[model samples]
Target: MASALQYIEETIICAEILRLMPRFLALLLRALIKRCLRSHEAIYVTLLPVADQRCLERDTRNLGHDLPKHADCIQWIMESSSRKAPWSGKRVVHELMAIWFGSVHALTTTVTFAIHDLCLHPEYTEPLRAELEAQYIQFLKSGRGLPLLDSFIKDSSRLTLVESSILLSLSAK
Candidate 1:
């Protein structure tokens, strides 16, 4: 049997026609919108009937009315993708859902506990704040090339889990 990663690669490489069509339409719509925007025309355009056209319209209207031009450009780049090759829409959605769940839960729990710990350990507040400031200075000096800051942030994340059992386990022989 193929490994899980291999199976995933194969599935993405052979995505169905129905799965591929919407993504292609989305890309075309995005390109047309971009062209319209650059030509000083209205951002709204009639999109091909697809499930995601409403989403596209909402995003475009919000961009034209509310978001700054630079932000809208960034959003367009982030959201649009070309579908020249097969990619399983179902698999992409599943992966995104998993990441959203993991990040949201982990970040929320970590921040909650960090605040609680800081409140309980008031004596450490000045020192911790000083450390943060020192790191910020170092980041500024190095043009933000601060691996140590990243390490510290990651360590802080590990130390403040919602439950001890949520930590990863290591097996010893």
Candidate 2:
């Protein structure tokens, strides 16, 4: 049997690993999607021209060049103690680890529970599928409306009980 300290250490390590895993999986999936999209070069080119062109431009300007430097500066301040100056790498890594922890824990638990509920609720599956299909048709017909789909998603998420911890954490934060 493990000692108490050993058990606690193991638990912490396990939690850290769990936190890191989803970030890794997301990175992998994003790369895979990018690769798949690149493979369909013509389709991408045709759609790229008109697909929320301003939104794309805004994201490009706001996201990459501006955000990371500001985040790094804040991270540096957070990592610095009064007595000692902060190292940049340590600050950046610490902030990244915090982000990984928050995103992975919440997203993994929510998605896992959602999948499990969908698997268990065989009777509701067809109706839910039909509802989604009908919603898509309605969305195409109307300029904007996501009522049925949004409600279904919200209800499913509520029933899953996955967001409780996330809500608590957000409140604490």
Candidate 3:
């Protein structure tokens, strides 16, 4: 969604597509979007059984030397996969694409719905904002906790689950 947000803001077409997509009769449109993104990535890493492991190695080298240490899902995947088996670049890329697709969609939907609810219920906003701000400062200073923010996120995710009825109807079609 963050990536989509960039395009959505820069282009009316992307914004309109996003607005119209949810009302589509089926999830084919969303699936197409995911496939399109996947195909683009596949050009770099065929995600085939024979994909070169050197890409992951180069990325790791770049991470340590060229780029600053950063916490990222792909990095975690590389590290964890290396600890287990002979690193398969294809498997890592495949898993990374799947994880990215699931995370982007779920998080974007969750955050959007949460913000919409917060806007509708202004009464809860102030308290949440206050708690987040206070905890954010402490977090920046000590890096210890963010209990209220964490709870709010958990509640938001619980409240805004994609309706199973919608999924059922789509699948029936």
Best by lDDT: 3
Ranking by lDDT: 3, 2, 1
Each candidate's lDDT (Cα)?
A: 0.40, 0.45, 0.54
Model 1 TM-score is 0.34
Report the poorest 10 consecutive residues by lDDT, candidate 2.
1-10
Residue 13 lDDT (model 2): 39
Clashes of each: 0, 0, 0
Measured by TM-score, the strongest candidate is 3
TM-score of predicted model 3? 0.45
Candidate 2 structure quality by residue, lDDT tens digits, 117-166: 67777766777678767677777888466564456556667775433443
How well does candidate 2 match the true structure, expressed as C-alpha RMSD?
17.0
Better candidate by lDDT, 1 or 3: 3
Task: Return the candidate ranking by TM-score, descending.
Answer: 3, 2, 1
CA RMSD of all predictions: 18.7, 17.0, 8.7
Model 1, 1-173: lDDT tens digits are 12322322222222222234466674464454334332111111111122134344445665675533333422343245343432233323333333433454556556656666667767667776776666877667776644543554465667654332211110000
lDDT, residue 126, candidate 3: 81
